[model samples]
Target chain A: MDVKEDLYHALLMEYASGCLDEGQSLIIAAHMALSPAARKTVAQYESVGGAILDDCCGKVAMTKDALARVLDKIDCGDSPSPCVQKSKSTMAYMNAPNCLQTYVESATWTDGKGGYQTISVRTSCHRSKARIYKIDPDTVFRVNTRSPHQLTLVLEGSFHDGRAVYRRGDLIVTNGDAVLHSDAEQGCICAVAQPSVFSVKRFVQQIFIRY
Target chain B: MYITATAVKSLAPRAPHSVNKPMESGRAQPKTANTNVNGAHHKSLLLRVASKKDREAFAELFEYFAPRIKSFLMKGGSAPDLADELAQETMIAVWQKAESFNPAKANASTWIFTIARNKRIDHLRRVRPEIDPADPLLVEDDAISAPERMGQQQETEAMAEAIKGLPAEQADLLYKSFFEDKTHADIAKETKLPLGTVKSRIRIALEKLRADQKVKELWT
Candidate 1:
């Protein structure tokens, strides 16, 4: 497989295995929403999980009253409520995929260097940080990666990373050495996740460059 | 959760492929003792629960799967008691959500596996965001023909068969990924294999599964 396909394959495997953190999981979930092929592959991988579970029959036994407890819970009407659907009005202005709607709705954007706005997305896993970035039309946004791996997913419009133009739902995975200079046309909104490595020099440069 | 060498070795002998012969001819072979029998039986039981709210069917499912689900949780390092609780919760979710189960989309084992996985995530104090299948922006598989859609019902069985036929090492890696909740990086660290090799092995395994499905489709 080519590099892009390879990365996507790896991501799908991790996602199917349920090993990805919340931020990374969101990205893959959104991508699957936009790509039927990815969805099919993920389903395949999950079937493998089911197969493994089936193979594991009788390894560890449950308590004898397990079924009785579950039936009691069901009879008592105490099961948790189903997931609440987002109201249409709340989803009205959201341009991101449904998987990301809640996060995007609650995020507050702050102005950043080079004519872009960003919001740090709250994530449970401390190993990585997630953020959403919005760039204006005809603007350039530069990000110097300090983490070993960074994943970017385009949510709206398009941006050229000097190699190819990435549109909505496209994912880009890069390593630390790559300096990304994204030029947006018609503006852009993207979600990014990387390890928790912040370069103080890069932050200082961005702050001073804005002045 | 840590998987000991002894645990993996004990599990390897009972891997499904060793028991089920690979499909050779589409029409000639009789159904043997394999997941297909159990899978189809469970699918019907779930459907009965969905259609009739049959407590008997639900009880049967609980008898079969609850133990497996508990074992699964324990393998992932949950305390035995916690695993038992989660397993009960997962079965309850299965009963409450039975109406939503679509055999065309996934079999009972696969469906319950997802529910169990979600419970495990909740137990870890983590979230697993997923696409809303009903999302307006979601891509539709409208191009798939009716026959292909019908073929999807068998896709899971094909996958199980495919996995059974995999090399032991690849199957072990997959078990680690799904059962132990190990990422490729973690598998590499544990197995002392390069990260790339782990990824590639998994990729190859998935490709083989897909290829097997395609071959089965041609026969259908």
Candidate 2:
């Protein structure tokens, strides 16, 4: 809460612009849930960026099939589980108390009720239109009928989202699914994060589709 | 190809409207694309640059980053022409020094950003030619202040209403601070006033920006 003003502003702009890395993004996202004021600041900055992007109507570059192109360029094939990387870094910083361990351990969680569980973290890492959301078990964590789906992947944990329980070695399909969800009790924790403005874009798309 | 001078350059290909057409396959695919070696790891882009012989990748990197560098330099007070020239130079440096790029040290954007910031500092020193880091003028005062001040004014319409309500000197400082990114020294230099006086005006300007009734009303 006592973050430097410069750091706050820098983080605000970075978070709003979807410029932060995954770790930073996750930190900010967690903060958004804890601090309404930070969330408001983020929303406010997003408004600023939205206005800028709007004014930039034709100024910002729009890659045709950019999502696809960037996706193809990435070599996700047989890549090591992201948790290994996370734990490795966490291990490097293991000097800290048990909190870091809990943080990584929380990457896989049980609902504590045995009813539902989260499986893995799914992220679409487009710089401006990035997102990281958790995939919960017993629930599809469905993108509403009018959501723009980006690249989805399992970052950590495992659970059955109405399909197979994708463990560490599983590669979830990036696209070609209209709807899906994890239904296993061994809850999954995947992220469905996206850029803040994509919701707005999706809203507009919804209106367009309805019209 | 004329390069199809469109209003905006599209970096990724978009799916065409017609069904018969298969989208051109090789540009880059977001989905099913090569899994990124670095997933937004701050230095992912720079790490990619570390390996030699990725010239096409380097150019793509340059194309996206150069304009941003130009904008950053210009915002920090370099002349437009100078910023543009330096931007090109920075890209060249990126190419020549790509081998030495270290992802462990800094990410691509940060590395490029540092290069630009350094270039601007170097340019400032050359243009001013006065060695005086001790000058209060060079101090960066844009350090994080209360977030409340940054709100509402983010919108130009709101800013316009707020600025209309500010005293002229205060308004001038606001413009100089945000628009020209002028330091206390530069503002003093421009207005022929003492650095202390410039700082006071900037504070007063911030007050008005902070207290804009329109912003207050919107927030409430």
Task: Please name the candidate that would achieve the greatest DockQ relative to the true structure.
Answer: 1
Question: What lDDT tens digits, residue by residue, belong to model 2 across residues A1-211?
Answer: 1112333344444444433444335545444433345555555444332221111111112234432333333323322112212231222222211211223432333332222232222333332232223344444443343322222334345645453456432323222233445534533433333333444234223321110
lDDT score, residue A139, model 1? 63
Candidate with top lDDT is 1
Which predicted model would earn the best TM-score? Answer: 1
CA lDDT, candidate 1, residue B104? 68
Clashes of each: 0, 60
Q: Note the residue pairs that clash in candidate 1.
A: none
Task: Kindly list the per-residue Cα lDDT of model 2 for residues B1-220, writing each as its tens digit.
Answer: 1122121114212212111222233212222112122224323444465665454565566555565555545545567666666666665556556677543322354445444543554454321111122322222223334443333233333433454455545544443443244544455676666554555554544445546665454333
Which lDDT tens digits does candidate 1 get at residues B108-157? 88889999988898778777789987789997854656776565545556
lDDT of 1 at B108: 83
What global local distance difference test value does model 2 have? 0.39
Looking at candidate 2, what is the lDDT of residue B40?
Answer: 41
Predictions in order: lDDT:
0.70, 0.39
Question: Cα RMSD for candidate 1?
Answer: 5.9
